[model samples]
Target: MRDSVSKDTLSDVKVQQRERGTLWERVRPGSLLMLVATCVGALLVLSPFLLVVLNAFKSPADYSTRGPLALPANFDLGPLQSYLDIIDFPKALTNSIVISVVVAVVGVLISVLAAYAIGIGRIKMRTGVLAVLLLGTMIPQEALIYPLFYIAQATGTLNTIWSVIIIFIVLQGAFGTYLLAGVLGTFPRELLEAARVDGASRWRILWTVVVPVIRPTLAVLMVFFFIWTWNEFYIPVVLLNSQDAQTIPIALATLRGQYTVDMTVVNAGSFLSLLPTIVFFLIFQKTLSNGVTAGAVK
Candidate 1:
């Protein structure tokens, strides 16, 4: 009886080991395939950016003759300099920076205040207000262009950076309010009550308590707003007719001629235009990630 029991135990162990091995084998292939697919997707998304960077260093002659994808036979800085001269890179970049920064800062401030009122304060008609704000996001810019142009023209803001900045602030503020309202709604009510009980005024409570707690979310919103403002093309093009007020996208478009466009020069300017946004993301990526995860978990 003892010998038979030992043999049965040994058989059971062997069977368990075989099952474990089979499970691992199945999982390994699926995981490998997922990794491969992710890599392929990343490659596809990054290929155009890579092409722009690569072609930026090439000469117009090389770009035209050797194909856009080809490596430059020799490094050439002429196209970059040419692009800078054509676009007046400094003025365009400065205008973009000013417009984007002011929009982001003002937009965030308005959004946080509005979101706090709606989400935390639980004001009357909060739901209706949120719905309207979100509805604004759905309205296509194309539809609003003529109306916006007329408004800018009447206001005498056309052909000025403020025209773009004002529009950006309003549009971005609505989006920020929508995002932050959800995040602020998840705040612990007890904390606010405690602040009030300790004699904190509404403004003090907002600045000292609510702001600190929701800073991550604010960072995320600011980054998004900044990027959107920086990349805004349509409004700037429609409003900023003068060369002095034009931003990077409009300047880049101006590089293209009706008859012919220089691929290398265009690529060079495009790559240069992307640098500020890339730097901004790299700097704020950690905060952005934390904000996203915190919002999700809360």
Candidate 2:
């Protein structure tokens, strides 16, 4: 009995030693170097955003005269205050929110349906259709501008928000077809075959089975579309001629004059413009990660 107890004691001691060794291993030189490097990179990336945040709180005089690195003498909302007045910030915010939500929703709906058709449905001429879609992606927007312009002029869509939204949804089809089709192709064939065997219609199977399985990919695509459409400058600038029809990008760019610049209010408006994309990415980062992993698992 004593010999067995001694052996047990020695085993416990060895386990404790191993635990300590592992803890020390985690704190070694290489690990410490990696930790430091990550922290430095994060700080460097965040510095510009921090500067903007700090500058947004400074008065125009403080912004021009005070050193950027120096702590503010006092936090002032004058920059933000002035921007709200000049740009009609509240109205612009509402416009941007409505445009982004509509574009994202419509883009996702159209793309998801197209992807489902191309991804899982077996049909003749599918390869031909896919080729055309991919060819559309290869055609640069710059190259197509003339045709798009003629279409807009002919359709009476120029200088309108509908023009922007319609163009966004059509542009989404290319990348959207490719991305979502790839994701849907990864679904197990057995799940689909089993669903069909159980008498579920194509639409029913899509809603009940396929959608839940590929929801992560859908979330990733939605967030991606939202960011791209929100930051889009060219399409909106070209299509929206009037100030009232203009989105945030044009509004912000117009803030800078030919002879003089209003850095204070411009920075504030730019910061505000970045908020939607930032919030979206942060919110959907986890689902994005999961979608990538789920795709890989297939």
Candidate 3:
């Protein structure tokens, strides 16, 4: 009994010593270096955005004279107002929201259906289908632009918002198909088998079992789809001619002049353009983290 008590006391002392160590002492030098490197990399990545915020409210004179790094003399709303005047901020904002939401929803629906068929249906030639989807996603938008343009013109969707919306849904669905198909491929079959034994229809099992289990991943895909569609400049610029039809990126791009650009106004427009995606990511951040971790589990 005395020997056992002495061993227990020694173990307790060792644990206490570990707990009492300073955090810096506990963290290895390599881990500390990684932490510092991560912080620096994050700051470097954020520098452009920081510059935009800094200059967004500055006067033209203040920015040009003192340069982009200098602080603004006053929080001038002029640049923001100029952006609003040059482009209809509210109208363009509304168009972008509508297009992005539509694409996210429709894109996810198509992907889920394709993934279901490929991942769970045990379809023949599944490998061929996956290869096709992978190939489709790899094709650059530049290569497809002309064919898409011709189709849009043929269908009378040219210069309208629907053109871009349709383009993204088909394109984005390809990626989501590849991602979710892989996820569903590795999905535990026990739940599916149980559902089948319970006489559940394929559709019923999909909704009741499969969908609920993978919802976090779907949310992440939806958020990505929305942001990707929202940031689109090339497609919208080519397809949307009217100011009222333009999305925020295209609207901001209009601020650039031929020889010289009004950078203060451009920065203000950029901030406005970036705001929605940031807000969206913040809203879905928890789901995104859950999705990433869940994807790693199996």
Candidate number achieving the greatest lDDT relative to the actual structure: 3
- The per-model lDDT (C-alpha) reads 0.91, 0.81, 0.92
Q: At residue 106, give the lDDT of candidate 2.
A: 86
Tens-place lDDT digits, model 3, residues 62-123 = 99899999989999999999998889999999999999999999999999989998999969
lDDT of 2 by residue, 193-219 (tens): 999999999999999998898787788
Candidate structures ordered by TM-score, highest first = 3, 1, 2
Per-model TM-score, in order, reads 0.88, 0.86, 0.89
Candidate No. with top TM-score = 3
Weakest 10 consecutive residues, lDDT, candidate 3?
Answer: 18-27
**lDDT of each residue in 194-262, candidate 1, tens digit only:** 999999998999999999988887888888888888988987999999999999899999998999888
Per-prediction RMSD in angstroms?
6.3, 4.8, 5.7
Clashing pairs in 2: none
Assess candidate 3 and give its TM-score to the true structure: 0.89
